[model samples]
Target: MSIKINTYITILMLSSAAFISPLITKGQSTSLDSSQPETVVQKKYGLDPSKPLAKRIGNTPPEIIQKFRDAGMSPTLHRLSKTDSLKVVRAFQMLPPLHQHILKEHLLGISFLDNMPNTALTATVNPEDQFPVFTITFRAEILKQDVSQWLTEKEMSYFTKDFPGFRIAIEAGKLDAILYVLLHEATHVVDGSLGILAMDQNKGTSGMAVNLKSFTRNIWVDRTSICPSYTDSLTSQSRFRGGGRLLPMELARQIYQSAAKGPFVSLYATSSWHEDLAEYLTVTHFTKRLKQPFRIIIHEGRKEIFIYEPMKSATVSSRISLMKYFYAKAGSSVLYERHVKPGGRGFNG
Candidate 1:
């Protein structure tokens, strides 16, 4: 079976502003009336500043707008919500203000449905006339379960030797599975936006196709786009598990060994360059820069067989440099702090 690389990568990846001026009303009061029983009339508006920008203003689709509204979030906003509205609102508020703004400006909407079909977090773009509308969806319950299962002694040890505080953060609620998924997916959006991993619209169709652009220091150019190389690599991999496949013991060891020798960040990253970039950003941001320990330990009847630590790979650090290119183009001050390392460019250099 053949899968369109751009659309397939999008499906499998696992992972705005305003101004105003007001005119004076004929009988507007400058001061509040204390004694005359002032009647406060509330006015209703179509768009919200705190929510995702409206399609008219930001090019988000009407259907997505309605979906968020039905979920009690925002109409044209990059809003977030779950089945229960209040919890999602509070969770959204818990994020840093700059983080929230970056998301709201770039994203169209976020929905926490309990019945998402794929990974805990996945992204899809609804192409628009002006700018593509990106929507990120999450299944909170399934996502938590996926993260727990992925970090098992058996699975973790085979992937890397760099122990991360990911499990600890999950337990403490400081680093949630949903949040991790969101960040990974968000990196994809940032990548596409920066033209680092450029996406081209399929001719005469509404679908998107991956356009692998060359990565220089400052700009992304489409000279020798390696579209086939990425797609071929992804398809050549075994699909024992749906997304990227977790292999059997011997094969898995060989795969991880090969990955360690490669420029990819994680096992899943080997699937495609897009994924390679996403995992690179996600793992580095959480593990090295954040000073978190993402360690893995495995035992066989009483003996420990293997352990994985992702941050120790030189190849992984090299992939992280690509993010410096991304951050520089995004020009977001928050992004710098999010990915920037102390003495070097990004994520422990």
Candidate 2:
């Protein structure tokens, strides 16, 4: 079980049902009751109309999307209906090239091919089985301002208030948080794919040791020791509690505090990380690979405080020194490329 083989197996298994039509051979409608309040229906393998098989087992579809929308749910996050199996197939067909590539790659790495049936596959959970199909239902209306406010209180400010209907907080600029969540969830999926307790299996092993080492090194050396000047006492308390004995990076601590709030917490905080990482990566990719800089700012309005990088050379150098100090403490070397032609770039030393 290589990662590639696992992904292919998973894709093949999912494709059997996900790519098929919902209409049965008997020409009977397979649609579930749209009026049902519960968004998800995990039913046994049967032809029950109440728990339509088509919706629960395949890719998403337009009719299913309509049903969800009519029910005031976010279609982007709902499962397909039994009657609209074809829609699920088509939606898979509509997936963007990058998304499809990533999905296929991920599936191949998880050993999903072995469990796929020769005939059409139905969603089921056998007592002895691994690899369960997850139906993630997205309800946009429920994630309105109330949810957004909760995120704000947790100090996750990297979200957009513009999208009124349905916005995945992961999209707004929180790439770090999103990536962390993805990795964490994907770790679970890998365990299921391998039919082993992935975490427990690695306990006391070299792999676990490396992971712990990286975490410890990052916390003690690479991370900022001082709390962000803007961090409120409540947020500090939350971070201390959530992080336990681990020395959290300032940004990481802020994110952990925010994520402890609720479901939205993880999304909000992770998205912020995503953005930070993305920006850091982008800068590194285009310019020379360098350490990230840190700075502080004070806001006149509401007597609030914030932190950011300044466009001045002196300020940038100071931030860079802090980054270097942290990185060096973590037992990592900093490699700087020869300065390319500087064209009025404020901090291109």
Candidate 3:
């Protein structure tokens, strides 16, 4: 991802138009990390911003395959089959208008990678550029599973090993995995667009002050670290926060107890403020608007040891009211499924 070339394209096409004639709801999707430098991920995978969303669905880029090697994982590019492609497109269509609007405006393209353990989006960020454009890369297998199966697999990555009688499960029912992932990634888009997390902003440059966003105010000290009041040494040692080894299953109960007391929704949310925003929005929407369950079952041998449902926490509820910032511009109710459009337009984020 050459910041030079893409900056030219984005500045001329996207930034110029968006700023000159701003869209009703605006922003970019995904976090920053240019996957391949040979050519932009959008062009290599046949992504044309001029095309409609459905037409944009196609093969994964080779750069995505190479990116897995950085993590020592060998993943192949998996083009979407006709049936899978429809499911992917449908998932995008189901999203709220704010989400739809953000992706439609700045998404260069989206693709899949086989053998990839998780879903991710990469961006080429130039602080001078207001709207940082991005492309999404998903793990191809997600197309086959519902939200529960997908989330359970993802949530289990926190632990060292998964053995019988000592396991964790996410009983989130049958919401489509693609829908959940897209919504989750889209929140990152909102973060990038609204400067919600400030990770890609010019704050890191010397003499530049870090002013935390309203969403991150008391929770995060900076993009990578949380406030001391919210930080606990135990959860800090969990896999996601630079802890080398995974945690033991025996500590699941203690983990949930500490997490429930914090502003965080999940252990993974503790990874950073960027992911914190993503996980927060994803869980709230999944359980509230979608009317689904998000339960974490930690089992010890044959017995259920601890169950932590984020939706019920007082700390979690505090964040829900703040989510209105995502859609409040249109004066729509916070976290509601029926996204009202600007003035009187139809729901189309």
Candidate 4:
């Protein structure tokens, strides 16, 4: 896949140029059971690794921040104001209960920094468990953006250089960027926790194994390569796929046209099956739940050249069946978005 991968302390982070940096403190939390012995119980409040993220928000430790800098990521840690921290709360609330449930069970906390190279990434909190605790870091700038701007900006980065007079616009609505990004990054957590992307081998589960064949089985033979039938010569070499050079804007029409016929929801979804699930679910949610139109408007000097709407394809609709797992509703709202009735089974959770 063209995207970067970093595996640190068992499992780390995944984003555009993904990194799994060591972004935790030296301290670890232990169970309250008297059966276990401990010397000193040191807690750093919001920074404590023992507590799964509750309400408090905090920054990464100074040393961990330096590690990210050394790895060529955001070098400056951004201290959050009270209003900024509330933004995170609002974003977390916007998530489907299932997404929040998965993160609360395994995620440690979220971090923020200025000038981040990626939208978001996950790091280890307690790496010893089969399911390690996670911490996700965000580009502090998300607080200043809306979903439309963030989605458009992130989508634009796939191409190498900009098109002189042409620009691609992702016409999603004006929701908060934190909600959009947090949804995408947290879905990775769901995939890592549940086996939605059964293709991933890094989720910390020790026993609750999922069915081997995933939603990606027919579409992707492996994490990176698409099935022969789905791979178009034009779209396969996308700059997002480790292609030798960045393609020009003129090529976008053909690339997206080829992708619309395929099962993927967006061009970036073609990066990896892991990304496929993330993009597919998030983009679909952006459209269906929020009732926003995910239109890729290519404008040439204020005149529209081409407009690509990804949802109209029959291929994407066929895959909507796979989405039942994400929407299965139950009293366990915290767990399943929707419940599968008899005769119909959802993602083999």
Candidate 5:
């Protein structure tokens, strides 16, 4: 779409802060009390301290068993409900053979539950749908008791600002927060299983549109920007001025190009598209399936991150027209084909 690449870069750097935060140890106890001020210990050796214990174990598969032993904790993966565990396993078995292999290769041998002195949290997968689902549940009373121990061990005040909500939640046995966090991470695993993250190996000129057959829809790129006059009108209003609204199509095109310039996209469009599409699909699918309206809340003084939502009005004829516009501007074929089946469905990768 011939965007000023520099402008796009600026937007990305600014917007990343809100959506991207340093990973926090998922299962670790934190002393977030007022006196403690939520201090974080940065990981040494490039390890992600925020990863779940099971993931940490999985990451260094062979060493995990030894590390747990050395630490003198008898590590046992907690099993939630037998029925739920069976359902999750059956769901995994029902996936396509290749996907099953991917799941086993990537996620097998990982523990789904952790037991602490006073509390326990167990992870479970729900596979009763088209995609695999992961969840975590906590034993409320035990979790609070454990949290109290954590705070005391860290020598932190219980009344601190950061600790208030967390302490209250833990004491009340409100597991929704933990549940949401697990759901978010589990979504990542599901995306990978669906081959939504594969890379397109086809080498072609810049600005060429690549058909992503795995998505069951054609992603079209067109050379267009929001009408200057319309953008000017929107900018005059403080509400829209924050990020400056653009036409939905134009916004999508800008994001597509910006993502194309990202690290993974250089080596493989498919892989890059996987993350891009995952973000897109998550936002869209959540809105549709959960009935939550999509909203982008921007902080004006801060940097901007671009959000793209596919057009509900998009049609094959309209997509063709958009492709032609880019083809004419690039003066090249500007089209790389991926196979799609009739009835608008196909394998993702």
Candidate 6:
């Protein structure tokens, strides 16, 4: 039963990555301001030019012209509700100081997009800025929608038991799940902005190459050593989508049991290197900082089936050191000391 659960969870995670939508989607046919230069964008937006972003962005506040606003990309899209808007804004602010600085400045702008299904969250390199000015677009419906209903029965049951307020928080628009999704997508923006995970492209048409020099390699190889089934090719990889391949309820139960003994935080973490890093960081932040529990228990008519506590996984727990280095802030360090083990090796590279 446990082995079957592991197999299906693995399949669901990998499939979720394979079907992620494109990063940038245009609305109302709004073209980018490609003529704008990097320096000019920085100056115009009041972003800090002195502080350059490489891989490790230190803890510093950014000078941002705008915090959050409409994308002006489309007329069809409507404004987000006050509760939802405040929730999103507060979520960004809740990030550790180090990440707060990077996001405030480089994040550029955030807008609501109703065109996409609630399941979609997208980011794009703002055309107005040459140096990684990102405009994040969230499917507006997501904030008001009960996305948890989309989870598989096994996932639903596990979360309900593990995270006490899981469904209630989602309904009230206060769950870390929304914040987790935001942080995960925001990581991509930071990764692209800092060249931490650059897309390798050749001069001709051999298709883009995969480079693991930065965060990608650290997660795929140095950290968890992601299963080959998830990383055989870029096409097979998965991101942090709310949906994945569905399995029979019985099979789903088996998969969850098998996953309990695995190294990854959640089954979704096995989708790809990028997702692995994002999922690890998000879950750690949720469980450690937010005081939430990430455990899995299956029951067959009252008898215990299996139990999996993510924070206790040998492989998953080892990455706490890397998380500390990634943030390198007082709060994150303290969180690590309080929740995760005292120390381990920091970032792989």
Please give, for residues 40-132, the per-residue lDDT of candidate 1 as tens digits.
211111223356422212234355344444544432223333433444443454433334544554455555543322343333342211222
**Candidate 5 residue runs with Cα over 4 Å from true position:** 1-76, 81-110, 113-195, 200-274, 293-349
TM-scores, all models, native as reference = 0.54, 0.27, 0.73, 0.76, 0.27, 0.57
Model 6 regions lying over 4 Å from their true place: 1-19, 24-38, 43-76, 126-130, 145-176, 199-245, 297-306, 329-349
Model 1 ranges with Cα > 4 A deviation: 1-8, 11-49, 52-102, 121-125, 142-174, 199-236, 240-246, 296-298, 325-349
* Clashing residue pair totals per candidate (backbone < 3 A): 20, 34, 6, 9, 12, 6
Regions of candidate 4 where Cα sits further than 4 Å from its true position? 1-54, 61-64, 72-74, 160-162, 199-214, 330-349
> On residues 178-289, what C-alpha lDDT tens digit does candidate 6 reach at each position?
4656776666554444333322222211111122233343335323345443332321221332233333344445455455455567665765455565667777776777
Q: Against the unseen true structure, what C-alpha lDDT does each candidate score?
A: 0.38, 0.24, 0.59, 0.60, 0.26, 0.43
Count backbone clashes in candidate 3. Answer: 6
RMSD of each: 14.7, 19.8, 10.9, 7.2, 19.2, 12.6
Whichever of 1 and 4 has more TM-score, that candidate is 4
Itemize residue pairs with steric clashes in candidate 3.
Answer: 97-348, 97-349, 98-349, 100-349, 101-349, 165-301
Q: How far in Å is the alpha carbon of 128 misplaced in model 3?
A: 6.8
Residue 86 of model 4, lDDT score: 76
19 Cα displacement, candidate 3 (Å) = 36
Better of 5 and 6 by lDDT: 6
**Candidate 3: residue 41 Cα off by (Å):** 15
lDDT (Cα, tens digit) per residue for candidate 3, span 1-349: 1111221111101111111101122322222235422135345534455677656555554554554555466767787788887888788777766676656555666777776654544443222233445566676788888988877876676675645568889898796888887777776655444444433333341111122235677787765678899988887886556554466667777878888888888777887666776788888877777788989988777788789888898887787866655554333432122111112111011
Task: State the lDDT at 181 in candidate 6.
Answer: 62
TM-score of 4: 0.76
Single out the weakest 10-residue window by summed lDDT for candidate 4: 338-347
